[model samples]
Target: MSGTKPMGTDEHDAARTERLRKAMRCLEGGQFAQARVLIEPLCDDRRADVILAHALAGSGRSTRAARMLCRLAHDNPTARHPAQDMMTLLLRHSRLEEIEVTLRATLRQTPDDIRLYDQLGEFLLLHGRTDEAIEVLIEGCRRHPSALRTGNLLAVTQNETGEAQKAQALLRHLLSYHPQSAMTHANLAHILTVDNRMDEALHHHARALELRPDDPHIHLNHAMTLLKAGRHAQGWPEYEWRLRIPGRLKYPAERLLPTLRQDSDLSGQRILILSEAGLGDMLMYLRFVPALVRRGARVTLQVPREILPLAARIYGVERVIDPLRPVPAHDWHCPFGSLPRVLGQTSDIIGAPIPYLHADPHKVLVWEDYMPPRPGLRVGLVWGGASRPGVAQAQAIDRKRSMNLAQLAPLATVPGLYLINLQRGQHARQMIDIPEGMQLYDPMDDVRDMDDTAAIIMNLDLVVSVDTSIVHLAGALGRPVIMMDRYDNCWRWQSGRSDSQWYPGLRIVRQDRPGAWDGVVARVRDMLLPARPDNP
Candidate 1:
């Protein structure tokens, strides 16, 4: 405000000008309440008022802001952009009645602003008004055929609404002109992955990485491609890049021997190993902890507060530190996953001991007392995962990849074998869908996390799950687990192999083609059917 130029000769005009500048500064600093205080009286200038309303809307004061913007738009009939912005704010925030009024009024004012139409369409899609969104976006695309954002959003809508071919066509058309568009490449790669075209997805993701080398998203996608393509040697490094990605919680910084030279001595030194990422990843990499302990380092590991009590009881570590507590001092530190690189891992050196990692016996005993006994061979089932942000986000709810509760009901009737429910969250609702006459053990109703989940898993004879964290959990425990995978299984499992470099006791049941879980399930049934002797 101090550096502001006078907008007009009068003192009032100059004062208003300075006030607007102050408001702009406040808005940029995310102090919207202060911005509103400065800008509220400046509604006399139509342009200034519109900008202020936009600031308010962005700050989550949508109701008052939307009304003010609408009024400002009405006062100046020629200001279509502000009117559109107001309508968008209404569509995003206002009640349904207000949204309808805003939409109709805005459309009547500018019947040809295709971007406005696109915004309304996107709103409709978000609110589950799919049919309306599709109709509107289709018309907008027809009018503004070159609008890349509109086309991309429309393509996603189409894909979700069961028009995969149309979505593919729209994305492909966009790619024709914007050949180097990283977003387009990523979206196309997603479609290709669903279609079982792993090679095509890999190429497009590679192209995306070339276009935006530093984008963590593209790097993650590339890592997914490599994992899916059975190139684990290169994939794990890029996968570790999540820690440095913007907006993600960074691994707690610590002083360390920045360079762990090949000849570094670690005899009797106290080391801190901090867990990063999800519960599944922590479990997956715990196999390498014993290696650190063997190096004569007294390993004190840190994990999320919730998992600390259980992790403390895990084998191979002298102590477990909950990050919520004051961080204990150590000679050197590294993230949980970085141990592989620090220990100089190569393709030849899996260095993994099956069942090397162990949870607390006390907790396992606690779960054991709660688990109900079944008649015969005990089998655990987990068909879904906690929603992950990257590639696994889309795969999180694939009914095609997961065994339908009803489809699995038949397994329950198999004599002498009991089905245990190990799946969690929204997917756990499938429990109600289980057919009568099948015994289901559901100790997970009170189980809080992987530690509890691991305890329950210890009591079961076998674990059958789709690609999920539980698969990793069961494998780390050196339990016999069947991993039912999509045709192009996750890269960690690799290609054309039943054995995994990550887990020794795991067996893979893979789909022959895209969305072909029926065959995979049938193979699983074949393997389990004979083991259940009382089936006759």
Candidate 2:
């Protein structure tokens, strides 16, 4: 009986080990559902619980996974797996308070752990708490003077807080000691790029890439630097690495079409163009469809439902379909942003003829009555962009690219300008502060989709907006546009350009410094006052 018991125990142990191995493989392959099914039953096992928490996070149960990870980390502080997993889940959910508490508690238990300080500071910086992050990282560097990563993050936080010189000094100092550190070089390259020191930035960028050839982020940064320098010949190919970046939009590999070599024949080919990224991006990139059709290819565009009506009117488009519907048969597929790379586009060839898009004349006439017959310059105003609440990355961009109606106070003083409230979403409450004498019309209730917005724009004399889809809509319709750009602008705008090469007659009003919307508003006010002299 004892000999039989030993054999039975051996068989049971073998089965458990095999199951664990299979579950681990599933997790590594991103089959989180399969992994969760296998892991949930083994939660009693401590090692399995860590993997289970990860599976829970991957499967969108982030809050539950965070709680489980916190328990595991509290129970076993020596193993970093649980703490690392907890930090990732908490950051993704933007639970900043919980992250601070958990990191502080862990630091108390292991007071000398430099890694905890690095994690705390980096997480704060990611959430845009730059001042607090700098303070923590300074202390971290003081305690562990040899920690390169801590120093690097401190420098980055300093850069974010508008201390570019300090960031450069710290990064250069780090390089003096650890010249082989690819991260320090990359950070320095980024700061240089932001300062518009392209030649020096390219030198450091090349050095960093040389040191870390396998790093996708480094490749992505190099690509942008190349594009900024107008070296599109090399930049386009490097930009393909963006697909490998975490948290960026990922297309199905199987659906990706073969790269169209420069000036390659597309005759008889059926090409599918995906509307990737933001609405503005779709409007900007749709210009290439006609160019593709010129090469004799049948082109189909898949766009969001809201933009379908406008996108259907693009020249040379064989069909416009909803992205939610099953895609039609095609020989090749490409994301909208990838057209420049595939079609050999460059800065010199940009700004393909304007008036590529047209609004329905009937819809345009309908909106004319909506506008008051005021004897003034009609202007459309969009002060805010739609963004998800409580998301760190989205909030950060919104903070830079969006503003409250109150910030446009200078515009209210511009006489002979009839302002129309083109602002979308719940942010219209900001209009409550629109001084008693100033009148900004609100017809947003009737504005249903881009089709309606396009029609409304066609009726307006000019469109004044921050970086939003409205700017793209006006530009595509060949209406005059004034874009209020942030200090660190999008790549499509290119660097140090007051006028966009992609959109003819588009004027940019840029912030001289970050968060300085006052200057931009004042400039727009100054420009408007002279243009409309009939008011005063």
Candidate 3:
């Protein structure tokens, strides 16, 4: 041996291994600064790059660390860890454009990386770029023919974009190979539900539940499918799983009031009704309050402030308190949505009654002066509802149930109908381009609360609206409403029926296809045109 030791000598190799072991220990112990110091000298080693990047990220230099990881991933195409870390950092910062660029570049170098395609496609879909996501996933399926995950995601995106037939085919193909996958069955079930193939949807839903009995998302989907098929007897119990789903309120059952049981005798029990779900849901379920009262239970309603005044007007509610305020003591509690299940209500009982909610007589008279006092029919229009950007559920609802005010241009051609704008929030600004000679009134400014909204609805001859709280309010007041429903409407509306059992006075005009508001608006116009007092 020479006087100088070789680079691969036992002593040199042992020292290098010891150094790496200590660095890993420091990193595992959250000693990021120490780990970084130990690992920086070994940055030239390909194996040390990932550890160095993690250390740098842990030390709060995430941007610099992200750059390092991206370079590492680019240089090492076969190393999945570096690429995954880089994508994670990019996603945490919402650098979607950067992620797209980085993923596309990496895919060019390593076209066989199925995960990259899945990640890119999911990111695109989540950000509302459905068409682009579909393209990416389709390519991914072609490259990785046997990849079940990629195939499932592609089918889901396809269903979301109204390509249900394509999604159905893809899911069926996946099921043929991976029949044990719970997610695949769930995706197929959802597509079938959208296609109104309820029997087949239910079969798939049952199979999915059998595979993954504890999956809340699967249970929630099953509930919706059953409800959509007008099978409420089985649906309501499954629907209760919503409270247990992630991202929803997760208060412990013990910490909150005791849940009222279906078979419980409540002749003198003090029951609390917690207002759950959205404003529309509260309005829709308010009918059950009187039903509870009829059972001789003293009902106390906890509601949002906006609906406090209106909720207080319910005939048998002993006290109406805002949820923001201190809660009153009660023997048991039930969410508004649970009433149907507790009452064991089925579709047959949906025809019970209407006008469950009453407007303030005084306020109704006051709104009379605010009306345009025209001779023609006064129709209320709610083109949109509240939807914050970036929330998937809200975005999906807005896309399905809302339309641009300009899309309602066809309605302007119909004469003798004064279009009263009941649209609130930012969507009211859309009324700027009302067609010339169209009699339109904007009273959204004075419509302060649900009471005011109810009062205004009472003045209109017909309320034409999307599936929003206003429609529920109008229906609850027994007003004749023409609901401009989406293809995938809420469970209450059901399917293939012009009339609703929940609101007997309401007539639904739904889209034959998703995003086809033009047809819906045209139908409304034709219906209005033929029925115009001056027409025939």
Off by over 4 Å in 3: 1-88, 246-264, 345-352, 530-536
Per-prediction count of colliding residue pairs?
2, 0, 0
Rank list by TM-score = 3, 2, 1
1-536 per-residue lDDT for model 2 (tens digits): 35544457888778778888887887677676788898787778787887787666666665666567667766765656365665675455555565566566656655566777788787777766778888888888888776788889888777766688898998998998899899999999988887778899888988998899889999888888888777777887798788777755445667676555546677988989987877988888777677777777889999998899888887777989987888788888898877777666533234357887889899999999998686889999998887767676566677778887887877877768899989887677888678656789988888889899888888889999999888988998899999998886776677889998778879999888877889999888887885445534
Q: Please report the candidate that would top lDDT against the real structure.
A: 3
Sort by lDDT, best first: what order? 3, 2, 1
Candidate 3 per-residue lDDT, tens place, 1-536, comes to 56965677888778877888888888777676798899888877866877787667666665666566657756765556365664565566555665566566656655777877887787787778888988899999998776788999898777777788999999999888898989999999988988889999999999999999999999999999999888887898888888787756434465443334445556877888887878998988887787677767899998888778888988778999987777677777788877777676433234236888888999999998988777878899988988867688787778778888888888878777778889988777877776555657888787778889889989989999998998888998999999899887777777799998788788899999988999999888887774546655
Error of 3 at 481 (Å): 0.5
List runs of model 2 lying over 4 Å from the truth: 1-82, 88-99, 122-130, 244-264, 345-348, 388-391, 531-536
Error of 2 at 195 (Å): 1.6
Root-mean-square deviation of each candidate, in angstroms? 6.6, 6.2, 5.9
